[model samples]
Target: MKIFTPIIINGLAVKNRTVMAPMCMYSAQEDGFVSQFHRVHYPTRAYGGIGLIIQEATAIEPRGRITDHDLGIWSDEHGLGLKELVSMVHMAGGKMAIQLAHAGRKSRNTFEPIVSSCNQRFNDKYDIPKQLSISEIKDIVAAFKQGAKRAKEAGYDGIEIHGAHGYLINQFLSPFTNKRDDEYGGSLEKRTRFLLEILTAVREVWRGPLWVRLSADEYIEQGHRLEDTLKVIDLIKHLIDAVNVSSGGISPSVPKVFPGYQLAFSAAIREKGLLTFGGGLINSIEEAEQALAKEKADLIYFGRPLLLRPFIVLEAAKTYAPELVIPQYERG
Candidate 1:
């Protein structure tokens, strides 16, 4: 089926349309280094025949971590473990990418003052983050550049800028969170400036496939809508390879989600001439095939299912597209 077809993005060829979405494992050490768990967890999925494995939300700095245990690429020392992880994934016959992220106001594990576009708390339970100064913003941008450099040095196939899920980048993009009167706020173009600058910096050092994951719809009354994200994509589409479309993390209100709920957002972004990876609650090969066949998204990202069954892609291939199954696993 079309789900098993090979596709190319920014010169990087993936074996199939099945992608492993970046899911925070919260399994790293306090120093943000990869532990034994990650060493085994990622390669297992790679061996399972996933086309691309986007590693979890790795912090660009200590303060950016979502939890004390989130994986990181903030320093050179962190590269050693990640480099080894990348090698294992490559050996397992899968392409790998890493998501560079900062938790912003949502940062919960650090004692250092959390900084965001504006001084707002994600919720009553979370601490109010300090507003970032212009110079500090520049520093964060440089940090992202360094993160990209580390990813390249670690042999990552690609890098994904985590602009989604109410992180630092998403905070800037959403009006509800970004209440600044400065250049990084107000207009849509202004709100997207942080991400654009990050992409610009990352592109300078990393000449590989780059993806941006965006909270396409904030799922709130005054949050960023599909049209707003289209404008953001239009502004920076030329710099990145593709977009991983996901939604609703800017607020506490949970979106009414179902199978293929985010596909429409992906389709909308795809219509704007941007390649997109999208899927939510997608569990069956038929669902994946239907999404790809309908031209909703260029790739399908399996999250929870992959976590529960590491070899899900292999199982699907064995049942529906036997020719795509790995030869060694054929006997099974």
Candidate 2:
């Protein structure tokens, strides 16, 4: 099936179209060092036959962590453990990418002050974040660049900038959150300036395949929709190799979701002639194959299912396309 077909992007080749989406494991030391859990968790999926595995949201600064235990690349000291994890995933024959992220107002790390594009609080559950100054914004961009460098040093095959899920980048992109009248706010172009600058900065240090995860729709009034996100994509498409499209998380509003609910957004992005990774609530091989056959997305990302059953892709191949099974597991 087309789902199992090999595809290459920006010189990085994967054995198949199955991508393991980044999911925060919240498993790390207080200082954000990789724990033994991460060392074992990621490679397990690689052994189970995932083509590309994007490691969870890794903080670029102490205040950028979603939780205190989230993985971090904020320091050169953090590289060794991540390098070991990458080596393990590569040894298992899986191409891996690291998602460089900053949580902004959504940060739950109480040790440092949270910052965002504006002073808005995500909800009553969190504190109002300090509005980032122009210089501070530049510093954040530099942090992202340094993170990209560390990602390369850690032997990652690619890098994904976390601009989605109401994180720091999303905070700037969403009108509901960013109420600043400064150069980084107001018009859509202005709102996208932060992410554009980030992409440019990261590109300076990491020449590997670059991906951007975007919240394609904010699911609220005065929030970014697919069109808004498309405009952002248009502005930076030249700097990225693929777009991972997922929706909501710009606020507390829950989206009406069903299987493949976000595929339409991916299809729209793909229609604009950009590669996209799309999947939400997708589980079955038939669903994955149908999405590919219908040209809904360039790649399928399996999240919770892969977390629950690491060998799900292997099982799918064994069921419908046994020829695609990894030879190591063919004995079964």
Query: What's the alpha carbon RMSD for model 1?
Result: 0.9
For 59-150, candidate 2 gives per-residue lDDT tens digits of 99999999999999999999999999999999998999999999999999979989999998999999889999999999999999999999
Q: Clashes in model 2: which pairs?
A: none
lDDT for position 199 in model 2 = 96
Off by over 4 Å in 1: none
Clashes of each: 0, 0
Structural similarity to truth (TM-score) of each candidate: 0.98, 0.98
- Which ranges in model 2 have alpha carbons more than 4 Å from their true place? none
